[model samples]
Target: MPPAHPFDDDKLREECGVFGVVGVADAASFVALGLHALQHRGQEAGGIVTHDAETGFNQARRIGLVRDNFTSPEMMARLPGPIGIGHVRYSTTGSKGQTAIRDVQPFFGEFAMGGAAIAHNGNITNALQLRRELIERGSIFQSSSDSECIIHLMARSMGRNIPDRMEEALRKVEGAFSIVAMTRTKLLGCRDPLGVRPLVLGKIGDGWALASETCALDIIGAEFVREVKPGEMVVITAEKGVESHFPFRPNRSRFCIFEHVYFSRPDSILGGRSVYETRENIGRELAKEAPVEADLVCPVPDSGTPAAIGYALESGIPYAMGIIRNQYMGRTFIEPTEQIRNMGVRLKLNVNRALIKGKRVILVDDSVVRGTTSRKIKEMILDAGAAEVHFRIASPPTAWPCFYGVDTPQREKLLAATMSEEEMREHLEVDSLKFISLDGLYRAVGEAQGRDDNAPAYCDACFSGEYPVAPSDMMEQGFQAKTAAE
Candidate 1:
């Protein structure tokens, strides 16, 4: 039976994350290490493709985490090459129910022009429209992901250079994306015009690496290089590394601010800001905005733990692990069929009755999506004898589905998306609930609005609907009604 939470809603859905390395003896091994670092961005499927003079493109993929997928020693030994690209995927727009090996990536195709394999992050808002158009033009699609559309488009573009062809293909598509492409002799990286997803370049010992986060570089002992500029494409080959300008001037980089707020690991660096510092800053700002009296400040677990530390330090509240997380549960845990999805939260976390007995507690969390998990956790705490549970969200309420890659429920499903703080408090049965203001969040990211000379940055569309790319469908749906909707 499918797990109770068949949707995998407990963890944020990562569209995908990519890694590429060249001129390394242990190219496949290093690529595996990089993918392991990026495993947090995606967990559903993993793959790697290598390039060598003997074999143009050798590949392997499986339906699980990097460690699970690349478990066979034979699989690693077979992938002998000095250059390669790896990927981890969690589908956003495609068939979430699919378990087919063909659907896993580093998708490769052999064309009259030559052969190329690709890995990508982000979702195309106009994918439906573009897919229909491509189909009409006789471009057959193998996978449901909007990502496949780019490859077909690249094949069709009649540009002079590979980079120009890539540019032409990107010009035809709209939405958030950060792509990495590999051929027999080249590795290429591109960011969406708005820079909604992140891509970073790194350098080491006459070789280069590209990945979704700086954390990956740190894992492989590569020196950090600059971020791939918004709307820019860079192609690396034995000959030279090529960078081209954005086709048109973008107003500013609309990077997914959530990368700092929740999606990225606290140890990574993004958009010139330390992800950990940004999260802590949010906690400090949240504490300043809404001071609560409590015996201890406790985090939801994992993602919420760093913010809780900040909140504890700023509010002068002692911090404690009021809830303990079960370390054994993973993507394949057997629970959905026998257990309820709402009850799934307890499989991973249980309230420590000893820690919260008769004490007022402040709960710090990154954000509340469907509210099922939060509600369940809150109930567990109260049942454990807490005098009161006050909830503080590190970021503003998320009211919109993220087309960029985040897997949020429909509008009406989000608790805060539909209701006010008061309404959420009543609904979740918490003593109080408060969220950080959008302004406070921006301030915490450590950048002034107008400071950066290249790329003015601000893309909080999930909170403020000022999208760099418009939704193909007219009306927005699926967010929850505000707590106090009248």
Candidate 2:
């Protein structure tokens, strides 16, 4: 048949990134800059919606990079307003190609309270069930995106104001959501009760901003205010400053642990911990747990570099660039077909034969989903005359697929789901392969006492397989439900 898709082989993809601003001149410009900083989170399509007194609502949506679409004067000129929201999307709930643009978000709805636009960053696990209920009740969906359910829910709410209506609508929804929304006069941000996604608040000159990460705020020269607390909604207006409301019953926070391992920008801060530092700590922990005698420690490049540095420092091994990545190469996982992905890995990475020849090499990477990429890289390393190849992973084996915004392969497809460490090492044709322990990962992220079995401090569903929120839609669709211990 066909070669497996690269994303299925190794990479886990996040769904989208959102940014919004209020009380700024040409607000869409700031929104564009913010989205540009977040382009790493999602690269397929981007859209910006702005609200102006004279222009009403202005929208620009396109299927490409932010720099390709939003940087042009003509495009910026089309979106003029003092309040705006933008979204960069990588489809998880919708189809791909031309038709997918219909799902490009900052989805707008004309509610009884006027118009409201929302940009969402996480997946709603119960969207399919909610959509069926809404459709039966006469709500017409404009797009196939799960995010559309929020707008329709708001449209049907009888709450007195937009905020109350939004709270009412969200209460009926389930799963991870970090939402940045805009109305005629307000900018809003809120996180799911479990805090499975991230949303931060920032301040610009006299205005306020909301973004999926703090790096988005840094791009626009905004001061970091704080995170939008879990289960809490923050509403900002020029006259009223900022208002906070608890829309869901308080629960233990369960921020996605993968944010520190992957997903987030190195410069961004999540849960008050620096992403870079956390990565380095993961490396240190990996060194302690699985030490290898090697000629050199080399990273897979970019994502694996920080961890490799920590590994080298902890083990007193020399760190070298044994594999160099093509800086200009597009993300190989985003290639549409399996054939392109089959050839894409070579286009993105090259072995430094000069450095790797005759060396006992240790390769560091964030995580391995499918064993394909690892196996390929091992062949490349062996061809370059490496005496031995050892693989050091920063995170634990990805045993479960993430249903909350992160795109993962089915459980049966995950290498870790079926293979033991020894079996994986042999399968990848490496001398040794070691992944960080679940407890080690927690320590790396600053949870010193390790993961709380009673109530996990972070959402590690991919590793632990214990979903904090019930994946109602998946269960209804016949996927087996699992508990943390299972």
Candidate 3:
């Protein structure tokens, strides 16, 4: 059996994070540092692939944290090269077991033209359909991962160069993707047309870096250059520097808004805005939309802290640490069984009885998916002798499942899919519950006038049920979209 997850299982999980660097000495070490910074994006497995002129290619793929797997000098010494790419993976499409290691990436493939290794972030919605077609046409796959489809597609492409073949391969795939790939002579990066996931460009010494977030670049002292534009491919080579190409038709960018609310590290910048600042703005907006009288404002801890600070500032309520998190616990939601999940909250967090007793408390959290966590936390606060509890959710109710890389539960499993705000309040036994408005979220992200109904600035499909990309494989598998409630 898989290890029991005793963390916040109700939360949505990001699929993976990708990083690549060219022209750096001991490039695998730099890639490892970058992956360590992005460890929050994934925790199950990590891998790095490097290419040297004399040694050709070297790879290290392990099923654990970057620090645990890649920190050894012996391991780093084995992967010596001047060009490398790495990935931190949390499986979204493949099985979870010892066999799953086969899917752990920086998946390397040898082509007629040359050899390339690819690490990908985000989901390919049409992957199943494409995989079936490819298999029927005589493609032998190494793993069940959706990302492997890219390699198969590249093998069949008629384009001359690796970059050209990559562009051709991407044209046949659908949904969100931000890919980092490495060849003997080049490191390449690209984002999908919709830009559903993030990919940033950075510089360190004479080397160039491509990473899922700026925080990864910061870890190795890489100066942020800019984001790789949606639908654009960049190839970085020592002799030619960086060459850019637009492989897909240009489309209006639809960056995932959840990155600001929960996915990214607070210190990272996305789309010219600080993720921490956007979250704080969300709290301020929540305060305006739903003002509540309370003796203390307390965050759920970690993910909820910044928004809670902003909430207290806006509402003039005292901010206090009513709940304490155990520093050693990995996120509890990753546990596989119900028994472990039931014990997750207690293992990860505890109520501060001294602080919460006799206080009318307001709890600020990033989002509520299944309501399981909210219910458990409310019980904990009440048991600690809190007079009353109110919930201030930073994001709107997540009613729809995300098909673009985020691992959200089925529609029926989503609490908001069936319950209204009042209904959820009653379900959680909280004094009240209020989620930030959809337009309020847009404003918090810096769209001051609110979401443009005609052309919304960001993707809010989970709240609005207005999917920008058609989830083709899901539709074929009999999944239907749910309508948003008033």
Please tell me which predicted candidate would have the highest TM-score against the true structure: 3
Tens digit per residue, CA lDDT, model 1, 1-486: 232136336445656789998867758888999999998887777889998887667998888778876756788888889889989987676767554567677888665567788888888777788888899999999988778888888888887655667778888888788888887777889898788899999986778899999999999999998999888888886557545567645646778888998888788998777898888888998999999889999999878888898999999999999999887766567646554554667878889999899999999998887777788888889889999999999988887667677776666677766888888789899989999888778778876452232343667767765566776632343323223222
What lDDT would each prediction earn against the true structure? 0.80, 0.88, 0.91
Estimate, for each residue in 164-213, the C-alpha lDDT of model 3 and write its tens digit. Answer: 99999999999999999988989999999999899999999999999999
**TM-score between candidate 1 and the true structure:** 0.92
- Best-to-worst TM-score order: 3, 2, 1
lDDT of model number 1: 0.80
- TM-score result, candidate 3: 0.96
lDDT per residue as tens, model 2, 347-408: 67899999999999999999999888888888889999999999999999999889899878
For all predicted structures, in order, the TM-scores are 0.92, 0.96, 0.96
